[model samples]
Target: MASGQKKKWVDKMVFRAALRRWAQAARASHRMELSELREHRTRARRLRAHLDKLIHVAEERLALPMIGNQAFPRPVDTDWAWRPELWCGPLPVPGMSSVASQSMLGDEATMFHDCAQSELTLRQVRNTREADLAAYGLRMDVFRFDGSYLSLAIDLPEEASRGLKRSHLIRIDTIVEMEKPLEIFARLNIKHGPNTEQIVRELPLHEADINVEFDLAYTKLNEKRVEKLWLDLIFEGPEMNQVVLRDLTFSRRKRAAL
Candidate 1:
């Protein structure tokens, strides 16, 4: 037998022996804490029931669409595409509404406010309807707003940091349903060097007005100085409103050179 092969076999045996000892120690600990484990199980069942009831209430009030298995759209010559909501499973912090601003919707999204008297809640709803063609959507409910400004900021994934250039066109597509007619704006922010550039566009009221494209060439984008990218959804007069964002996607493509 080779010396190296013998050493490998001895190492494997030692690992197995260590694992066995650990498992035996774990079993003994579990036996000693069996009563505490039983109490934990009982509490866990109650928590599960409460969570189920909460989900039921959300479905009743929100009436979200069913989850679907459909693909999102992309522009021709697409270099990058991202669907923020459907990128992962359900959000850990599903809903929050209060006077204090927070970022409970995971690391990728944040909500900010400067209102003295207002309430805001954001949650991910299951998309069951086929028309949505997406797995999830964000529902934002607001009331009694007296804020200077409020916005939902979504951090783009790391894929966006591929060194954007002036020749790239960034497109934002969204489906919005509001309880009342309200002015909403979408802002694209790009951080380059020590400066940040912003491009703002008001979302149209009609369903047909669902897309906006930002021409990087129009801005002073230092191609070599590109750092980060993000999007902001700014709401104006959002009092007593329920806004459902059925879908939001971003795509980038090269602009046609004249």
Candidate 2:
């Protein structure tokens, strides 16, 4: 072998031996005397400090351009695009069970339901698929949903409504997987002065890439009074199903004037 390759192989073997020694020490730590245990603990803590830093850096580096990345295709003439916080990075609280109505997963996403008994779980998981653009995904498992209405709401950032106008078209793109056939609807709610304009579109689950567009021209949107906007993903007949949302993105573009 070349000198460089031989050196690397030697270093790898040394690393493996060191790790095995540490593992043996850990396994025998329970039987160690107090003095020896204290000494070992001190050394272990020092080693762990360096190992933790290494692991953190390695994980961040391995994630590459996925974490905190918001790059996605935008429609022609599009001026704004956004991916929710849940899909961009890890959440402080990643998973929840028996989620209550209006429970929020992150700063931007919330779950709502009227179920008498909460048999649901929501988790933010890493997306490892090669084609997944977002670093994270959301999984929802519903064992027995007894509610009449269920929806996961994502509040848009302020940028989405900034410089708002009536001639813009908003679009939603989602990568979703389901354990079984389920009907889902995308609802865009724009809250203006004392009024909320809503446009709902059923997702084409049959398609591989689900995309929906909402033309603001049809809504009675008071562009001047536009304050906040949010999107609601409503699920129909969601009982006993597992749904994974791999990625979701929103974009806005101006429509040609008549």
Candidate 3:
């Protein structure tokens, strides 16, 4: 063999031997005595810290940019557009099982239910599809759901309600995939000084893309007293099913006067 090739092969064999030795030491760490274990732990922690940094950098450099990109379509006359933080980036806590009522997944999204025994899971997964614009997606799995009510509430940013008026129309677009047939409703709630206005629309699951619009002209909304806005996604008969929300977006535009 060439000298250069032999040197490379020797280096690889040495690295493999070192890795095996470290693995054996880690496997036997549990049997170590208290003082010895403490010493071993200190060294292991230092080694782990360096390894973690290397792994983190390697993953970030090699993987696609899937954490912060938020680009989606909007109406021609749209004044504002938004994509919730949960769908635009990774959450600090990504997944939860046996979720309780009023559990929050991130700063903007919350899970609510009335089940006596919780059998639900919520996870934020990377959107690998080429056509997907959002960086992340939310996946929900339900097994033997006995809840009387189930909903996922997302708090809209303050900008959504800023300079609000009665002539504006709010639109919601989403891409959802379900393992079986199910019913879902999207409700928009706007809180004013002392009252709240709500509008509900059923999602057409049969369609490839789901879209709904709420015309503020129809609601008795106090434009001057608008304080906050939010959305609730209610699900019916979600038992023994899996649902994936690939993307969700919001936009606002002025309604044409009659």
Candidate 4:
């Protein structure tokens, strides 16, 4: 046989000898060895259970349509869409996305009650019912209101920094359910450098008219100076009202130039 083959045979023989010695040692302590083997098997079972749970979690995560950590779903349009309730998460802050006795409006949103002697609570609710809009909605409960200027403000995405032109039309669609009939207004505010322009529209009483469009062409928008944009949903005679905002969405499209 070749020298290399002979050396490999010798190495295999040495490995077998070591295994035989180990087996003999284990057999010599048969009872203790059996207990150790049983313990190892139990540990393996526990590890498998943990692994199964991890796999389940991973599967659920994969089932979601989110591209990354974004909680909202993607819109069919190629432009931007925002769902505040879903964007935050399942359990949102009580005051902002959720309403509790002492909860206040959440971050990235604000409320003005300069001269109020009332209570305001906001909460985010999961929409389990079938809907094409969002998986979540906001509920705002107001009681004993006494403020001169009252408005709930929500900030838009930072992508607005890209710039907005007079040729674009901002559209807002929302589903509002109120305990009592009241007038609610939607205002779009655009800040450009040192100037701020606002377009206001009264929400129609007809449920079908819950959509509003703001043509930037009608406003003095310095396209290059555009900094940020926000929306304010104002309520009239909102005292002792339970307003449930089922869905809110914003989109932009080029206006058909005249």
The most accurate candidate by lDDT is: 2
Ranking by TM-score: 2, 3, 1, 4
Q: Output the number of the TM-score-best candidate.
A: 2
Against the true structure, candidate 1 has what lDDT? 0.80
Give the clashing residue pairs of candidate 3, or none.
Answer: none
Where does model 3 exceed 4 Å of error?
1-66
Pairwise lDDT winner, candidates 1 and 2:
2
Per-residue lDDT tens digits for candidate 4, residues 96-200, read 422222223545566655543457767776544434245556777887766665677878877754657788777877777789988888999999999999999
Root-mean-square deviation of candidate 3: 12.5
Alpha-carbon runs more than 4 Å astray in model 4: 1-78, 85-88, 96-104
Model 1: residues with Cα > 4 Å off, grouped in runs: 1-70, 86-88
lDDT of 4: 0.69
Overall local distance difference test of candidate 3: 0.91
Deviation in Å, model 3, residue 129 alpha carbon: 0.6
In candidate 1, the residue pairs with backbone N, CA or C atoms under 3 Å apart (3 or more residues apart, or in different chains) clash, namely: 65-127, 65-128, 66-127, 66-128, 66-129, 67-127
Candidate 2, residues 147-250: lDDT per residue as tens digits? 99999999999999999888999999999999999999999999999999999999998987899999999988988999999999999999999999999999
Clash totals for all candidate models? 6, 0, 0, 11
The local lDDT score (0 to 100) that residue 141 gets in candidate 1 is 90
Between prediction 2 and prediction 3, which has the larger TM-score?
A: 2
